[model samples]
Target chain A: MRAQFVLSEIWIGLRRNLTMTIAVIVTVAISLALFGSGLLINRQVDQMRGFWEGRIQVTIYLCNEVSANPQCQENGPPTEEQRAQIQTDLEAMPQVESVTYESAEEAWQHFSERFESNPALVDAADPEDLPESFRVALHNPQDFNQVASAFEGAPGVDNVYDERQILNRFFDLLSGLQNAAFIVALVQIVAAALLIGNTIRLSAYSRRRETGIMRLVGASNFYIQLPFLLEGAIAGLIGGIVGSIFIVAAKFLLLDGMQDYFQFATTLPISELIYVILLSIVLGVLLCSLASFISLRRYLRV
Target chain B: MVGSDTRHHNLREHAPVINFDNVTKRYPTQKRPALEDVSIQVEKGEFLFLVGPSGSGKSTFLRLVLKEERPNDGRIHVAGKDLARLSNWKVPHLRRRIGCVFQDFRLLPNKDVFENVAFALEVIGKPRRFIRKVVPEVVELVGLEGKADRMPDELSGGEQQRVAIARAFVNRPMILLADEPTGNIDPATSIGIMKVLDRINRTGTTVVMATHDAAIVDSMRKRVVELEEGKVVRDQSRGVYGQAY
Candidate 1:
């Protein structure tokens, strides 16, 4: 019965401040959506790093007729002995997980397959134009510099290339985007907190007379505050629901919708999306309650 | 009905319901104290009028009893518990035993007469069965029987005050403090409110009313404590308002 009374009071309070309540809901929804998006982006970045970094290899290109390096020109394309020696040295290194030899013809085949979507670029390259190289997989991709330096001045070597260096640049761009999204999310969250506080204050101010009477009638502090706290929680709960819907819609439109176009990119698993939705709801409710509780402490003396 | 309840029989017959000993209260922004060196005792089952001119500490006196403000210099005891020593959390329990009616009638504008009175019980977590039973009884006692469903804006000044009174009395408080309960109503309606208070008092409840209503104070012939500039200048049984001056 008392719960019924408290619930009714919460309804009355929400109804009385309908406009302010909507403002709080919308602010909380937008902020939580941004926060959820940031979290999802962080997860996506980690997944991409895991998938790409595992495949990263340091490539050692042998000197070919078309190679511009002085060392490659002097050696005139690595002799069979030079190629065998380079492969042996790479396999002997402790950091080298494994080495795969890609001959000039194999390199041309891989390049052609990669550029299949751009047939014009594929037809521009001659089969003999590609260089024979040893693709060196490292036990730890972070040890790329050690592998690169080990083969840098080796005979018949045109140049040492760590795929991770280029991948790092791409990941850096993604990380920067994630950071920017997080910063925006943080600002929105702060705005949501302030908005919740202001709304609660206005509601409390408008009901001062009723609260004064409540105080006189001997209502406990908890009893007086329960309705207001519930009001904030309800608003936050609605916001969270809306935010979850937005995140799901975003996933459908941006991630799932691009499935065919970016088949190589990993999509966030359904479980992760569900987790984000649940977390966003919990965060929304907690943030709003905390904001209102602080505001009530400051403004509502009862 | 005085002394009819056997539960209250164990309480000392002459024990004061409210006691103030050399109590002094001052606001932070003001140099002069709102109440200065005031001492008074109100016995249970008595009707006392707190009469004073404007800014004479009448409201402060009632506020002190409510523990809304603490005295700076002295002690105050309500229903035998020292207000100074009471923990802040226990203030609600103290207030539960005392009812208060204000000059403005402080009714919830959105609530009907029934809800306004029932709100007091609802806030205290009274059982629904009890609320259902007690709300109508109190509403009938306040003579707003047919008007229970009327909203505050729909009621006259007198009816609103009666709703406020019913809310105060619903819990059967031992003491009822009226801070100019009849302040906003007309003289005829003020008399009606006074009669309702007198009825409650006769039922063994102590009544302390703060008012500047001379005619009601003169006609009621109750014990009157009059203050002037924070000092209690008169305490008379069957006293008339402005008589001390």
Candidate 2:
């Protein structure tokens, strides 16, 4: 019977402050949705970093007939003896994890296969014009500059290239996007919290007469404040469910939408999205409950 | 002080349900204390009137009994428990034994007569079956039978005050405090309200009413405690409203 009374009171309070309740719910929903999106973006960037960082290598390209570097023009192409000496020197270095030599013909073969979808690009390239390179995997990818400077002016070496430079630019852009999402989500969460507080305050003020009567009739403080607390919880739960739908939509539109253009970078799977959804829902409920508790403390001491 | 212990023991045998000892209450914003060094005792089952003009400290006395305001200088005891020593958690239990009626007839505007009365029981976590049994009986007791469904705005001022009285009395509290229960109604209607309170008092509940209605006080001829400037000026059994009587 007491539960019934409390439930009825909650219903009455929500109905009385329908507009404010809706505003709180919408704010919570938008905030949680944005928050979930931020988490997804963060995970995506981390996944890309892991995928790229593992394969990062420093390559040493030998001078060929079509080489454009000034060093390559002066030295022409390296002899078999110079190439063999260069390979043995690279293998002797402690930072070198392993070295694999690729001939000009093998480089052309790999390039054609990589761009097989673009036959015009394959037909435009010639095998002899491609440069033979020694690919060196490092024990620590950050030691690239040490190896690059050692091999920069070496015999038959055209140039030493670190693969991470291009990848760093891409990651930087993605990290910026992730940080922007988090900042906006933070602002929205604050907005949702304030809206929840205001809604609870207005509801308490409108029902001050009833609450006064309740106090006169010997109602405990918890009993008097129960309905208001439940009103906030109910709104939060609804907002969370709404936010979950937006999260799923965001995953589809934002992540999967870019899959065709950036096929090499993997999108987050369903299980991770499910985790975000559950977390967002729990956060929404807790935020709203805390805001309501605080507002009640300030407005209704009873 | 040695003989006082036995005297208090004897007093406990038929203890005054409400006791005040040199109680003084001063609101920070006010120039003078609302109640100053006021001492009074109200026995169980007594119908007492606190008669005074506006700002004479009658309402403050009621509020002190309710523990709504703490006395700055003295002690108050209701039903053998010291109000000063009572913990906040136990306040609701203390309040459950005291019902309050106000001049505005502070009935919830949204609730009808039955719900308004039942609300008193409902808030205290009374069982629904028990509420169903007692609410209607109390409603009829206050002479509100067949009008249980009427809203507060729909009822006359007299009827609304009766609803407030019924709500206060429904929980069967030991003490009923009425702070100008008849202040808002007509003189003819005020009598009916007083009769309802009188009936409730006859059922062994102590009644403390603060009112400015001299005619009703004269007709009732009850114990009247008059206050002037926060000091008790008269305490008479079977007293009339004025000194001329």
Top candidate, metric TM-score = 1
Clashing pairs in 1: none
Q: If you assessed candidate 1 against the hidden native complex, which CAPRI class would it receive?
A: medium
CAPRI category for model 2? medium
Residue-level lDDT of model 2, residues A1-302, one tens digit each, is 38988998899899999999999999899999988988887877778778777788999999998888887788889999999999999999999999999999999999999999999988998888789999999988889989998999888999999999988887787678778878888999899989999999999999999898888888998898889988999999999999899989988998788666677567687899999999999999999999999999999865
Q: Could you give the interface RMSD of each candidate, to one decimal?
A: 1.4, 1.3
lDDT of each: 0.89, 0.91
State how far residue A46 of model 1 sits from its true place (Å). 1.1
lDDT, residue B98, candidate 2: 96
**Could you tell me the lDDT of residue B215 within candidate 2?**
95
All candidates: DockQ:
0.62, 0.65
Residue A137, candidate 1: C-alpha displacement in angstroms = 1.5
